[model samples]
Target: DIEMSTSTRGGLLKGLGRKLAGESLFMTTYVCKSATGMITFTPEAPGRILAFDLEAGQSLICQKDAFMAAQEGVSLEMHFRKRLGAGLFGGEGFILQKITGPGLVFMEIAGDVREYDLAEGEVMRVDPGHIALYEPTVDYDIAAVKGLKNVLFAGEGLFLATLKGPGKVWLQSMPLNNLAAAIRRYIPSKG
Candidate 1:
């Protein structure tokens, strides 16, 4: 159990850096009153994500995956994409973002973020980065419609990332460009 308190001073609070097994604790840096904090997990790592709603003290499970991370007081669940004809039209994908409560989210990213708004009944097609974190209730699926072949091919790609109705989506301004840049800088070029 870790105890953290809010600091009146601004700028992100420093990380506590305490590790534990299956423990849920509050993150002071990203937490806020109106919105919840977010966190991301990487592959081949082991740690249990936990959250608690102050209103009820109800604990929530963040997610179970090597590529998963969590905030102190946020909850998460598995959301499945609906299948279409022969289950081939739509692919199987899962979004482990947020479930309930408003706080803060901690994300490990390569660059800054960019965000967009989707009005009620409005759908937004994004390239993963456009979505930092979102509510678990929203529906998602691969936007591989047959008619818009040109749009898919020319614009982005075959897989059009779609998010539906009434939730906040955070997007990173720069995409995976940073990863490639890092590799180029560190790894020696072989002539």
Candidate 2:
């Protein structure tokens, strides 16, 4: 086990926030004891690892299970997005993981990853499950699927999470939740 610097409420709150996000009860903090040190972390699912720098005053809002590890100075919080449409139909409940940083963070996404840099006023509508992370500057909302025919026959679900940005957003090509549902279709039923 690695020894970590500990502060009473600060340490406990960070772990608690992660737990509320469906993660393990504890966070492993690795302190570099020398000039340089290494720690290896891998998410349980098969996925791509992504890293980013979070400057002061910026926060990264991510999928519930996306966070992997971070430098010591980073902070963890929870976000309950206020978009009612997203809350009801976006698949990822309104509650999400919020990471605040003046530090570096590493995240894991369910499969191959793609990123987009959105200029001011640009927007993207995405399947909520495919959303991995985005800057707080991005405006996240939800939109209804346009036509009844498309909603009922497209198999694309009824609503999508919309991101309007002057910020960056990342998407995962294969969302584990979708993959699991597909795999369930082929599994033999309990006999």
Candidate 3:
């Protein structure tokens, strides 16, 4: 039903990079030779599918493993935090997914979703793992949890993602990792 155009140059490098990012080594492109055909990708979890259009010269950053599929011309790569502290203590570790395109991309966010449009200088702090995706225009950083009681007892981790935006941000109510941890607690462990 479809044809794929393979990259002849640097194919091995791209495949290796994707593998290090916890993705499949090969990215397949589907083309419909027939008059009518459709290509579909389904989310692994039962959650919302979010679509974003990336214009030329624009890019977006997403949580690792969030990328589902994209149009043929889009490019996906790894993005790193510049600060050493962020690399050491940030929620997503040192690297996130960076997508650049003049096309559309679909990503999956677990559970219900909330979207906020932030004006310049507006700031919101969120649990790092809950962040779905954000525009490049937004400034992202990590903040230490405040107060001894809250930091130690809240169970929300030592750092929260601080997003200062003049752009949009998407957050998910339930991250799949969180759900998996919760479920794991109930299952009887075999010694």
**How high is the lDDT of residue 74 in model 2?**
81
What tens-digit string does per-residue lDDT give for candidate 2 at 137-177? 99998888899999999988888888998999999988888
User: Candidate 1, residue 101: CA error in Å?
Assistant: 3.7
RMSD of each: 11.3, 2.4, 2.0
Per-model C-alpha lDDT, please?
A: 0.40, 0.82, 0.82
**TM-score, prediction 1:** 0.45
Each candidate structure's TM-score, on Cα atoms with residue i matched to residue i, is 0.45, 0.88, 0.90
C-alpha RMSD between model 1 and the true structure: 11.3
lDDT of 2 at 67: 86
Write the residue-wise lDDT of candidate 3 on 32-71 in tens digits: 9999988777888879898888898678888877889888
